[model samples]
Target chain A: MKTETTIQGLTASLASARSSKKMIGFVPTMGNLHEGHLTLVRAAKKICDVVVVSIFVNPIQFGVGEDFDSYPRTLEQDSRLLAEVGCDIIFAPSVEQMYGTQPRLTNISVGQITDDLCGKSRPGHFDGVAVVVTKLFNIVQPDYAFFGQKDYQQLAVIRQLVQDLNIPLEVIGVPIVRAEDGLALSSRNGYLTPEQRAIAPKIYQLLKQAEQQLRQGEMLEQVLANISTELTQAGFVVDYVEARQTNLQPIAQFDQDLVLFVAAKLGSTRLIDNLQINFKT
Target chain B: MKTETTIQGLTASLASARSSKKMIGFVPTMGNLHEGHLTLVRAAKKICDVVVVSIFVNPIQFGVGEDFDSYPRTLEQDSRLLAEVGCDIIFAPSVEQMYGTQPRLTNISVGQITDDLCGKSRPGHFDGVAVVVTKLFNIVQPDYAFFGQKDYQQLAVIRQLVQDLNIPLEVIGVPIVRAEDGLALSSRNGYLTPEQRAIAPKIYQLLKQAEQQLRQGEMLEQVLANISTELTQAGFVVDYVEARQTNLQPIAQFDQDLVLFVAAKLGSTRLIDNLQINFKT
Candidate 1:
C-alpha cells in the first residue's frame, strides 16, 4: 500500500484514481489499529475501487485531561496490517501536516445530537471529530466513507453533518466488531492491564443483559439503573448507562430503533460501547 | 437553460456533465439579479464548461427585525437574464426544498474575521452565510465558484471556509460591479426611493475619498470618523465606516492591503460597499 504524509501527495494520488473512473472509499482512524479498524478497511475494500485510510491521532478531539500525548502510534505495524488487508493507500499525516502551526478559525458543529452519551462526558469531542472528518472527506473527495458502529454517536453525527452540509457522499456504518467475550475492540484496549482486561468484557455483558431486560418488557429507567449498578459493582466506574433512539434522542420506550450506550472506566482506561436493539412491537 | 428546484435533479444533471468531463462554474446569489450578479455569472461562463447559478435568499443570514419578508425576489427576470448570458442551469430552490421541515443542526462558523464589519451589525450573519454557502458549494460541487467583492467580508469568509474545510474547489472573487453613479449594484438597492438611490452614490464616493486620504498618510481613525460624519450628515444613518486589512483584521496604519468599508441606512434602506486600497509606501 502507498503511504502519503502530506495532503498534496494524497490528493495527487487520488486524482489519478479518479481519472480512471474509480470510486474512492475513505476510512479515517486515530492510529493504533485493532480488529475494529481493519473491519472498516475490509468493508471499504469490498465496495470501492480505491480505499484510502487516514491515521492521525487528532489532538483537538482529546479533552484537556484526556490522552492526547499518551495515545499510541504504531504506523509500522498499522501499515503492514493495512497492506495485508489490500488497502490502496494510507494517509498518515503529522499533526502539523494535518493542522498547520497557525490556529484554526473555522469550526463545524452539530447541535442536539452532540449533547448526549459520549458527548456529555467529552466536551468538544464531537466538534473535533466533525472538523477533522470534514477535512478528511474533502481531502479524499470519496464517493463513500466507512465508519464502525462502535462509535455510534459519531456515526450519527457524521450522517447528520453530511446531510446538513449537503456533502455528496454516502456514510456506511459497519457493525461493531467485538471480541469472543463481547468486549468491543478499541485502540484504548491496549492500555488495559491484565486484571482490567479480564473485567472489560463485563461491560458488554451488562449491556446485553440490559437489552434482554428491555426486550422482556422491563421499565427503561429500571433497566438502565440496574445496568449502571451492576457495572459499578463489577469494579467499573460508570460514566453513563442510557437508552436512546438511534439518532441519540432520549427514548422512554423501545417502540422504535433503540441504542443502549455505555461509557465506563475499567481502571484508568475509558472504554465506550453501544448496542443497537430493534423492537418488533 | 435548465432550471432545477430539487437537489436530486441538479445532482443528476451535474453527474452527467461530470461523466462527459465538463467543468462546472457556480454563482450563488439571492435572486433579484443585478449587473453585479450577472458579472459573476459571466466570469463563471468564461472559465467553465457548465455554469450553474443558485438563487437562495437565505433567511438565517437576516437578523430579527431585518428585511427578510421584504427581500426582493425576481426569479422570472433572473431566469431571463441568466439565459441571455448563456448559463447552463439555474438552481432556485425554495426554503422548504433546501432546509426541509426539520431545523438545521449543523453550523459552520469562522472566527475573528466574522466579528467585525457586517458581522457586527447583523449578528450571526457570516455564520449563516458560511452555512448556506457551504451547503451550496457541496450541492453544486463546482470546479470554480464565483463571488463579487461588493460583499468583501463575505468573500473573505468564503475563502477562509474553503481553506479551513479543505473543500476542493477554487473560489474566484470578481471585482465589485457598480452603477455609472458609483453606487455598488445590490439586490437591496431596489428598496431605495429615487431620492435615496441618488444619495447612495455619496456612500461609495466617501469610501473612495477615505481610501485616497489613507494612501496619502492620513490617520486611519480620523479618516474613518470623517467619513462616518459625512455619511450621517447626508441624510443617512451610518452603521459603520472603517478601514481594515483585506482579511478584515484591524489596521493601525495604511501599510498593507487596506479596505475601506461602509454600511449606512438611507431612509429604511440599508446599503453596504467597500473599496480595496493599495499604498505605495
Candidate 2:
C-alpha cells in the first residue's frame, strides 16, 4: 500500500481509481491505531474497491488542558498494522499540512444534539469534529466512511452533519471492538496505567448492567444514579451516567432505541463507553 | 439544456458528464436572471465543459423581514435566459426539498472577516451563505464555482470558506455586471420603484468617486464620509461607506488592493456596491 502525506499527493494517488469509478471507502482516525480502527479498515476492505485510511491526530478536537501534546504518534507501527489489513492508501498528514499556518476561519457547528451528552461537558468538541470531518470528507470524497461506534456521539454528529449538508456519501458505523475483558478499544486507552487498565472493563460492565436493569423495567433515573454511584465507588471520578435515545435526546422512560452512556476518569485517563439497547413495548 | 428541480435528478443528469471527465462549472443564484448572474454563467462556460446553474432562493441567507418571502423567483424566465446563454443545466430545488422537514443541524461559520461589513449589520448572514454554498458545492461537485463580485464580501467569504475547508474546487469571482448608468444588477433591484431605480446607479457612482479620491491621495475616513454624505443627500438612508483590503481587513491607509464599499436604502430597497482600486505604492 502507498502512503501519502500531502492533500495533493493523496488526491493524485486516488485520481486513477476515481476515474475508473472505484468505490472508495475511507476510515479517518487519530494515529496510534488499535483493534477498533483495524476493524473499521477490514470492514472497508470487504466492501470497497479501494480503501483509504487517514491517520491524523486532529489538534482542534482536543480542548485546552486535554492531552493534545501527549497523544500517541506511532506511524511506523501503525503503517505495518494497516498494511496487514490491506489498506490501499495510508494518508498521514502533518498538522501544518492539514491546518496550515493561518488560523482556520471556517467552523461547522452541529446543533441541539451537540448540546448534550459528551458535548455538554466538552464544549466546542463536536464542532471541531464536524469541521475537520467535513474537510476530510471533501478531501477524500469517499463513497463510504467508516467510524467506530465507540465514539458514539461523534458518529452521530458525523451522520447528522452529512445529512444536513447533503454531502453525497454513506456513513457506516462499525461496532466497537473491545478487549477480552470488554474494555472498548481506543487510542486513548494507552494512557491508562496497568492498574487503571485492569479497572477499565468496569465501564463496559456498568453499561451492560445499566442496559439489563433498564430491560428489567427499573426506573431510568434510579438506574442512572445507581450506575454513577457504583462507578464513583470503584475509584472513578464519574463524569456522567445517563440514558438517551439514539438521537441523543434524553429519554423520560426507555420506550425506544436507547443508549446508556458513561464517562469517568481513571487517574488522568478519561474513559467513555456506551451500550445500545432496543426496547420492545 | 436540462432543467432539474430535484437533487437526485440533477445528480443523475450530471453523472455521465462527470464520468466522461468533463469539467463542471457551477453558478449558484437566487434566480432573477440579471446580467450580473449571466456574466457569471458566461464566465463559467468559457472555462468549463459543462455549466450547471443552481437557482435557489435560499431562505436561510435572508434575515427575518429581509424580503425572503417576496424575493423574485423567475424560474420560467431564468431558465429561458440560461438556455439562451448556452447553459447546460438549471438545478432549482424547492426549499422543502433542500432543507426537508428535519431541522438542519449543520451550520458553517466563518470568523473574523464575517464580524464586519455586511456581516456586522446582518448577523448570521455569511454563516447562512457559507452553509448553503457548502451544500450546493457538495451537491453539484463542480470543478469550479463562480460568484459575482457585486456582493464583494460574500465572494470573499466563499473564497475563505473554500480555502479553510479545503473544498477541492476553484472559486472564480466574476466582476460586477452593471447597467449603462452603473447600478450593479441584483434581483433585489426589482424592489426599487421607478424613482428609486433612477437613483440606484448613484451607489456605484459614489463607489467610483471614492475609489478615484482615495487614489488621488484623499484621507480614507474623509473620502468615506464624503461618499456617505453624498449618498444621504441623494435621498438614501446610508447604511455604511467604508474602505478595506480585499481580505476585508480595515485599512488605515491604502497600501494594497482596496475595495470601497457602500450600502444604503433608496425608499425601502437596500442597495450595496463596491469598487476595487489597485494601489500602486
Candidate 3:
C-alpha cells in the first residue's frame, strides 16, 4: 500500500482511481492503530474497490488541557497493521500539510446533540471533528466513509452533518471492537498504567450489568445513580453515567432501543464506553 | 434544458453525465436572473461540458425583517433566459426539499472578515451563504463553481471558504455586469421606482469618480467623505463609502490595487455596488 502525506498526491491518486471506475471507501482515524481501527479498514476492503485510511491526529479536537501534545504518532507502526488489513492507501498529512500556517477561518458546527455528552466536557471538540472530517471527505471524495460506533456521539454528529449538508456519500458506523476483557479499544487506552488498565474493564462490566438491570425493568434513574456510585467507589471519577435514545436524545424512561453511556477518569487518563440495549428483539 | 427540484434526481442526472465524462460547472443564484447572472451562466458555458445553475432564495440568509418573502423568483422567465444562453440544467429545489421540517443542525462560519462590512449590518449572512454554498457544492459535486464579483464581500467569503476547507473544485469569480449607465445589474433593482432607478447609476458613477480621485493622489478619507456627501445629496441613505484591498482587507491609504465599495438605501430599496481599481496594472 502506498502512503501519501500531501493533499495533491492523494487527490492525484484518487483522480486516477475515479477515472478507472473505482469505488473508494475512506476510514478516517487518529492513527495509533489498534484492533478497532483495523476492523474499520477490513470492513472497507470487503466492500470497496479501494480503501483509503487517513491517520490524522487532529489537534483542534483536543481541548486546551486535553491530550493533544501527548497523542501518539505511530504512522510507521500503523502502516504495517493497515497493510495486513488490505488498506489501499494511507493518508498521513502533517499538521502543516492538513492545515496551513494561517488560522483556520472556516468552522463547521452541529447543534443540540453536540451540547451534551463528550461535547459538553470537551468544548468545541465536535466542531473540530466536523471541520476535519469535512476536509477529509472533500479531499478523499469517497463513496462510503467508515466511522467507529465506539465514538457514539461523534458518529451521530457526522450523520447529522452529512444529512444537513446533503453530502453525496454514505456514512457507515462500524460496531465497537473491544478487548477480551470487554474494554473498548482506543488509542488513548495506551496511556493507562498496568494497574489502571486492570481496572478499566470495570467500565464495560458496569455497562453490561446496567443494560441487564434496565432490561429487567429497573428504574432508569436508580440504575444510573447506582452505576455512578459504583464507579466512584471503584476509584474512577465518574464524568457521567446515563441512558439515552440511540440518537443521543435525553430519555426519561426507556421504552425502545437505547444506549447506556459512561465517561470517567481513571488517574490522568479518561476513558469512555457504551452499550446498546435492544429490548424489542 | 432540464430542471431538477430534488437532490436524488439531480444526482442521478449528474451520475449519467459523469459516466459519459462530462465536466460540470455550477452557478448558484437567488433567482430573478439579471444580466449579471446571465454573464455567469455564459461564462460557465464557455469552459464546461454541462452547466447547472441553482436558484435558491435561501431563507436562512435573510434577517428577521429582510426581504426573503419579497425576493423575486422569476424561474419561468429565468429558465427561458438560461435556455437562450445554452444552459444544460436548472436545479431549483424547494425550501422544504433543501431543508426538511427539522432545523438545520449544521452551520459553517467564517471569522474575522465576516465581522465587518455588510456582515456587521446583516448578522449571520455570510454563515448562511457558507452553509448553503457548501450544501450545493456537495450535492452538485461540480468541477467549477461561479460567483459574481458584484457581491464583493460574498465572493471573498466564498473564496476563503473554498481555500480554508480545501473543497475540491475551482471557484471562479465572474466580473460584475453593468448597464449602459454603469449601474451594476441586480435583481433587487426591480424594487426601484423609475425616479429611484434614475438615481441608481449615481452609485457606480461615484465609484468611478472615487477611483479616478484615488488614482490622482486625492486624500483617501476626503475622497470617501465627498462621495458619501454626494450620495446623500442624491437622496440616498449612504450605508458605507470606503476603499479596501482586493482581498477585502481594510486599507487606510490605497497604494496598490483596491476596490471601492458602496451600499445605500433609497425609499426602502437598498442597492450595493463596487469598482475595482487596478493600480499595479
Candidate 4:
C-alpha cells in the first residue's frame, strides 16, 4: 500500500487515481488501530476501487485535560494492520503536516446537533472535529467515507456537515465492532487498566438492557435513571444515559427509530457508546 | 447557455462535464449583472473550458435591515448578459432549492479578517458569504472561481476560506470593472438615483487620492480623517475611510502593499470602493 504524509503528495496520488476513474473510499482515524477501524477499512474496500485511510490523531479534537499527549501512536503496527485489511492508501500525516505552522482561521460549526451527548462533555470538540474532517474531505475528495457507529454523535455531526456544506460524498456508518464481552472497541480502550477493561463491557450491557426494557414497554425516563444508577453503583461516574431518535432529536414517546447513548468515566479514561433501537423491526 | 435551477441538475451536468475533462471556471454573484460581474465571467472564459455562473442573493448575508428582500435579481437580463459573455452554464437556484425546507445548521466562519472592515458594519455577513460560497464551490467543483476586487474584504474572506478549508480550486480575484466616469460597477449601484450616480464616483476618486497621499508620505491617520471628512461634507454618511495592508491587516506605517477602502451612504444607498497601492515599486 502507498503511504503519503503530505497533502500535496496525497493529492497527486489521488489525482492519478481519479483520472483512471477510481472510486475512492476514505476512513479517517487516529493511528492506533483495532478491529473496529479495520472493519471500516474492510467496508470501504468492498465498495470502492481505492480505500484510503488517514491516521492523524487530531489534536484539535481533544479537549483541555483530555488524553491528547498520552493517546497511543503505534504507527508501525497500524500500517501493517491497514495493509493486511487491504487499505490501498495510508495518509499518515504528522500534526505539523496536517495543520501547518500558522494558526488556522476557518472553523465549521454544526449547531443543535453538537450541543448534546459528547459535545456537552467536551466543549469545542465537535468544532475541531468538523474543521479537521472538512479539511480531510476536501483533501481526499473521496467518493465514499466510512465511519464506525462507535462514535455515533460524531457520525451524526459529520452527516449534518456534509448535508449543510453540500459536500459531494456518501457517509456510511458501520456498526460498532466490539470485544467478546460487548465492550465497544475504542482507541481509549488501550488506556483502561485490566480491571477497568473487565468492567467496560458493563456499559454496553446496560445500554442493551435499556433497549430491551424500552422494547418491552418500560418507561424511557425510568429505564434511563435505572441504568445511570446501575453504572454509578458499579463505580463508573455516569455522564448521561438518554434515549433519542436516530437524528439525535429528543423523543417524547418511543414510536420510531431510537438510539440510547451513554458517556461515563471509569477512571481517568472516558468512554462512550450507543445502541440503535428500531421499533418497526 | 444552459440554466440549472436544481442542485441535482447542476451536479449531473457538471458530472458529465467532468467526465469529458473540461476545466470549469465559476463566477458566483447576486445577479443583476453589471460590467463588474461580466468582467469576472470574461476572466473565467479566458482560462477554462466551461464557465459557470451562480446568481444567489443570499439572505443569510444580509442583516435585519439590509436589502435581502429588496435585493435586485434580474435573471432574464443576467442570463442574456452571461450568454453574450459566452458563459457555458447559469445556475440560478431558488432560495428553497439551495437551502431546502429545513434551517441550515452548519456555518463556516473565518476569524480575525472577518472581525474588521465590512464585517464591523454587517455582522455575520462574512459567515453567510463563507457558507454560501463554500456550498457553491462544492456544488460546481470548479477548477477556478472568479471574484471582483471591488468587494475587497470579500475577496480576502474567500481566499481565507479556500486556504483554511483546503478546497481544491484557485480563487482568481479580477480587478474591479469601472464605469467610464471611474465609479466601480455594482448591482447595488442600480439603487442610486441619477444624481447619486454622479456623486458615487467621488468614493472611488477619494480612495485613489488617499493612495496618492499615502505614497507622498502623508500620515496614515490624518489621511484617513481627511477622506472621512471630505465624504461627510459631500452629503454622504461616511462609514469608514482607512488604509490597511492589501490583506486587510492594519498598517501602522505604510511600508508594504497598501489599500485604501471607503464605505459611505449617499441618501440611503450605500457604496463601497477600494484602491490598491504599491510602495515597493
Error of 2 at A2 (Å): 0.9
True-vs-predicted CA distance for residue B69, candidate 2, Å:
0.9
What would the TM-scores of all predictions be? 0.97, 0.98, 0.98, 0.98
Report DockQ per prediction, comma-separated. 0.86, 0.92, 0.88, 0.89
Across B95-120, the per-residue lDDT of candidate 4 in tens digits comes to: 89888898789998999998877899
Worst 10 residues of 1 chain B by lDDT: B245-254
Candidate 3 lDDT over A1-281, as tens digits, reads: 99999999998878888988898999999999999999999889888999999999999899999999989999999999999999999999999999998777889999999998898899999999999999999899999999999999999999999999988799999999999999999998999999999999999999988888987899888989989999999899998887889988887555688998999999989999889898878
When 1 and 3 are scored with TM-score, the better candidate is: 3
Q: Write the per-residue lDDT of candidate 2 for residues B1-281, one digit (tens) a residue.
A: 99998999999999999999999999999898888888999999999999999999999988987888888878999999999999999999999889989888889999999888789889889989998999999899999999999999999999999999999899999998889999989888889899999988988888888877877888888988999899889999998888888788887554678888888998778889988888765
lDDT of 4 at A93: 88
lDDT of 4 by residue, A1-281 (tens): 99999999999888888998899999999989999999999999999999999999899999999988999999999999999999989998888887788778898899998898889989999999999999999999999999999899999999999998899999999999999999999999988899999889999899989978888999888999999999998889999887889999889665688999999999988999999989987
Instruction: Write model 1 residue lDDT over B1-281, tens digit each, in one string.
Output: 99999999899879889877799999999989998999998899899999999989999899999999999888999999999998999998999888878778999899989887888888899999999998999899999999999998899999999988888899999999999989999988888899888889998899888878876888888998999999888999999887787777787653888888999999888899999887754
- Candidate 2, residues A1-281: lDDT per residue as tens digits? 99999999999999999999999999999889999999999999999999999999898998989999999999999999999999999999999999989878889999998887789889989988987899999899999999999899999999999999999899999998999999999888999989899888988898888888877888888989998998898889998887788888777554788888898999989899999998774
- For candidate 3, what is the DockQ? 0.88
Off by over 4 Å in 2: A252-254
| Candidate 4 to native Cα RMSD, angstroms | 1.1
Error in Å for residue A189 of model 4 = 0.6
lDDT of 1 at B273: 93
Instruction: By DockQ, rank the candidates, best first.
Output: 2, 4, 3, 1
